[model samples]
Target: MTFSPTTLGTGIAGYNFLLRTRATQQAALANSPQVARDTEHFREKLKDIQTSDQLMEDRAMLRVALGAFGLEDDLDNKAFIKKILDSDLADSKSLANRLADKRYLAFAKAFNFAGESGPQLPDGKSAEDVTRDLAAIRTADDLLGNTSLLRATLKTFDLEGDIGNTFFLKKVLESDPTDPASFARRLADPRYAELAEAFDLSDKVKDRNTVYGFASVFADAAATLETPEDLLEDETLLTEALRVFGLENDVYRPDFLDSVLRSNLNDSTSFANQLEDKRYAALAGVFDFHEMAQAALAEEPFTSTLQSFVTTLNARSEPVTTSNDFFSDIKLMLETYKFFGLPSRSNQAGYVNRILNSDRSDPAAMIHGVTDGRYLALADAFRIEEPNTDRIYPPEFADQVVTNYLDRQFEISIGESDESMRVALSMERDLGKVIGNAKGNDSRWYGVMASNLLREVFETVFQLPDSFGTLDVDRQLKELKHRSESYFGTSALEDFTDPDRMEDLRRRYLMQSNLQSSATSSSASIVLSLLSRG
Candidate 1:
C-alpha cells in the first residue's frame, strides 16, 4: 500500500483505525438484531484511516517506503528531488510538487561551473586557432540566443576574409554601404590590412556615403590589374574605377564597335594620332584588309599597291540604299571609276554583285543599273540622295577624267586609290593603242577590234542621243563610225550574208552598242560597225 510522506513523518495512522472499527460494529449489530439492529450496524462499518492507530504504529515502515521512492521532504536534500525527476515511474503528486516550484526549472539551463562538464580543449592547436574556434562557437550560440552579436561577428569575419583578397577588398570598398560599421569592420580585417594601407582606407569617416567613396579609391588603385578576367572577378571595383575615370558611359557595346569599324574604311589618322601604342596606331589595326595591306606596305610596296588597286575597283560598288537608285547608281559608280581608267571591269562588277547579293537591294535592279549606259546619270541620282560621291571617286579625281585616264594609263594603276581605276581604264584604252601599233595598215583583227568599238559607239548615239544628251551624241557617233569603216572594209559584214544571220547580227550590235554608249557617253562606233558588218 502507498502512503503519503506527511502521514508517515507525523505518525497519524492509529487515529484512523479506531474510526474504522466503530463504523463496522454499528453495521453488524443492525443485521443481527432484526430491523432495529440493522440501522445501528450500518452506521459503524466504514471509518477514516486518517485517525488510525495501526497507521501510527507502522510509521517507521512508511518512512522506509518514502525514502525508497525518493519522497524525502528535507529542503537541503536536492539529490532526492533530482532522483524523483529521473525516476521512470511517474507519480502525479510528485510531478505536481515540481510544477509548483519554478526555481528548479530555471536551474536546469544555468551553467554549473563547479561540477558539470565543459567543452574540451584541443591538443596541439595554437592559441590563436583556439581563440577563433571558441569565438565562432560563442558567435553561433549567441545567434541561437537571438542576440545581435552574431551579425556583428559575421561582419567582422567577412572583413577578415576580404583582407586576404585584394580584388575582393576593392569590391567591398566600391560596393554600396548599407551597413557602414559592417563595411568598416570588413576593411579592418587583418588580411586586408595591406590593401587598406595601399589605398588609405582609414581617412574616410564611417558613414554609408564613405563606403562607396572608399570603393572609388580602391577601384582607381586596382586599375593596374591586367586582363578582363581579373577585372570581372572584382566587378564592384571595376565599376567604381570606371565611374571615377568617366569610362563607364563611354564604353562601347558590340553594336557600337561594329558601326565604328564599318564606317571608317580609310585609316582614322586623327584618332590613330591620339593613341600612344603602335599596335593600335591605325583604325586598320582591327580590319583584316588593312592589316594585309599594311604588311604588304612594309615588305612589298608593289604588291600592296596592286592589292589597293584591286580593292578600289571592288569598292566602287554603289551601296544598295533604295530601289530606284540601286541599278542606276551602281552603273554610275562603275563608269565613274572605269572612265578614270580602272583595270578589269571584273573587280568593279564583282563588288556590285556582292552588295546586291547581301540583299541590301533588289538584284534585278542592280543588274540593270550596272548594265545600263549613262553611269554618270546614276551618279547624279545618288548625288541627290546621299551627296557623298566624292568618296566614290578614286583619290585622283580631285581633278579631271578622259585625258588623265588615257595619258597616265600605267601611272593610273601604279598610284593608290582612284588612280588604280584610272590606270585600269587607261590600260584598256592603251590596249587599243597597242593593237593600233601592231596593225599599222595591215588592218585585220588588230584594226577590227578598234573599228568594232567605233561602230558600236555610232549606232548607240543614232538610236538614243537623248540618253547621252550631255555630249554631241550624233556628231560623235557619226565621226567614230566613219573612221572605223574607213579602216575595216564593208567586208566586215560580208561573212553574215545569210538573211537570217544578218538580222540577228544587227540586233546584237545595236543592243551591245546601246549598253556601252549609255555608260561611256563616248561611243565605240568603230567597234560596233565592224561587228555589224561581220
Candidate 2:
C-alpha cells in the first residue's frame, strides 16, 4: 500500500508536532516506493515538453503539471484549460485575468506558451519562409496545384487576410506585365505588377529575345497591311499588337477593331477616339499603317527597365554575436538572472559577451570567477561556448516542478484522514504564492477569495457565514480587510509572510475548524458517534 502521511492530532499540540516533524515525514513520503514512482514517472515524461499545449496532450505530463498546482481534478476539462493557458494575463479582459480564481492565472504563467517564445528568428519555419519555387511554376495550372505558394504570394502582396479570388489571381498571372493596362497594371497596388514580373505569368518577357520578337513581329505585320481589315486575317499578328495597347480582349471583335484601327486618330469624332478608354485610340495610332514604323519605335514594347526590379529577394542570415542577439532567442533566457537583485544588464554587451563565451567545463573558467552569480546562470542557460544544448525550459525548471508535484501530493494525502488539516497545510503552501503574485491588497484579497483551500480556512477563522460569499465583491473585500486587520494586526497580507504570523494563523485555523466540527456533531440529533480526529 502507498504510504499515507500521518497527522499527529487535531489540537494546537498536534498541529505543532505536525509542523515540527513535517520535514522528516516529507522525506519518508518522498522515499516511499509509490510516491517515488509517481515523481519518477512525472520527471521522465516532462522532459520533452516546452509548451502548455504539448503538456495538455500528454495525460502523464498533465497529471503532474495539474497536480503541482492542486488542480489534478481538472484533468478532464481540456477545453477550459486550453482557454486559460492561451490567455494573455496582461490583458484584463483575458479569460485568466477575468476569472475571480487567480489559480488559473498562475497555471498559465507556469508554462507560458502563448505569444512569441523568444526574440530569435524562429528555429522552425517562419512567416518569411512562406515561399514557392517560382522557377517550377511554369503555367497558370502549375500555380493552382500549389496552394501554399498561392497563400505565400497572397501574403507577399499583403492580401492574405482576405479570401483570395483565384480567378483574379490567374488573370494577373496570365496578363502581360510589360503592358501597363494589363490585369496587374489595372490594380491600385503596384505590388501586383511585381508579382507578375516575379512569375512572368504572361510569358511575354521570358527573355530579351521574346520581347524583341513580339515588337519586331508587330512592326513587320503593320508595314505589310494594305488596310486594317487585312491585318485581322492574320490572328497571330493581330493578338500580339492588341496586347501591346492593352486591347487583347478586343481581338474577338475583329471587324469593329479593324474599323477602329482604320479610323483617323487626329479626329475626336472617330470611333477609336470617341471610346471611354484611350486604349482603342492608342491601338489605332500604333497601327495607323502610315506611322507604323515611328509608332512601334515610340511605344518601345517593354524596354526591360523593370528587369533589375524583378530580381529575387535574398534572405539574410547574420551570425549571433552580441547580447542583443542572444536575447532575441528567449528560450536561452537565464531565469536565475531575475533573482540577481540587480538592474537588467542585458544591454551590457561587454560583460555578457565574456559570460556567454566563457569555457564552463574548465574549473578555472571566467564565468565561475565572477562574484555575480547571474553571469554563471547566463553561461549555463546559453552554453554558447559548448553550442549544442537543446533544452526547451531551463534545466532547473524540471526539478522545481518535480518537487512541487511531490510536495502537493503529500499534502493532499494528509487530507484523506482529516479534511481540515489539508486546508491548513494548503494555506501555508498557497498563501505566499497568492500574496507574492498580486500587485496590491485588493488583488491579494481576491486571490484568497478565489482559492478553495484559502477561502475555506478564512471563512472558518473569521467566523464568516456561508452567505458572506453572496455579498458584492467590494463588500467582501471590505469585510476581508476588516477581519484581516483584527486577526493579524495588519490589513496588508504581506505581514503574514513572517513565520510567526503564519504559525499563528495556522493555530487559529485548526482551533476554529475543530470547534466547528464539534458544534456540528453536538447539533445533530442522530450523530453517528464516528467523529474521531483520526
Superposed Cα deviation of residue 497, candidate 2 (Å): 1.7
What is the per-residue lDDT of model 2 for residues 1-534, given as tens digits with 9 covering 90 to 100?
567777777867666777898888888888888667767776676557656677788877787777776778899999999898888756889998787666676677666556443111112222213221444465666776788667756654566753257777778788787898898889898877877777786873342122233344544343356457677888887766564443567879977886787777666788876876655665565445434434566874331111211111011133233455555644323322222212356475567677777776878867778764334433442335443323234323445566777778877887888888777767876888788778898888888988778888888889999999999989999999999899988898888889999988888889999998888878773454445422
The residue pairs found clashing in candidate 2 are 119-328, 120-328, 120-329
State which candidate has the highest lDDT.
Answer: 2
Q: How many residue pairs clash in each candidate?
A: 70, 3
| Candidate 2 error regions (>4 Å) | 32-34, 89-92, 115-391, 525-534
Can you write out model 1's per-residue Cα lDDT over 437-490, one digit (the tens) per residue?
343333333233334332333344335443433456455444444543653333
Worst 10 residues of 1 by lDDT: 2-11
| Model 2 global lDDT (CA atoms, 0 to 1) | 0.64
Cα deviation of 468, candidate 2, in Å: 1.6
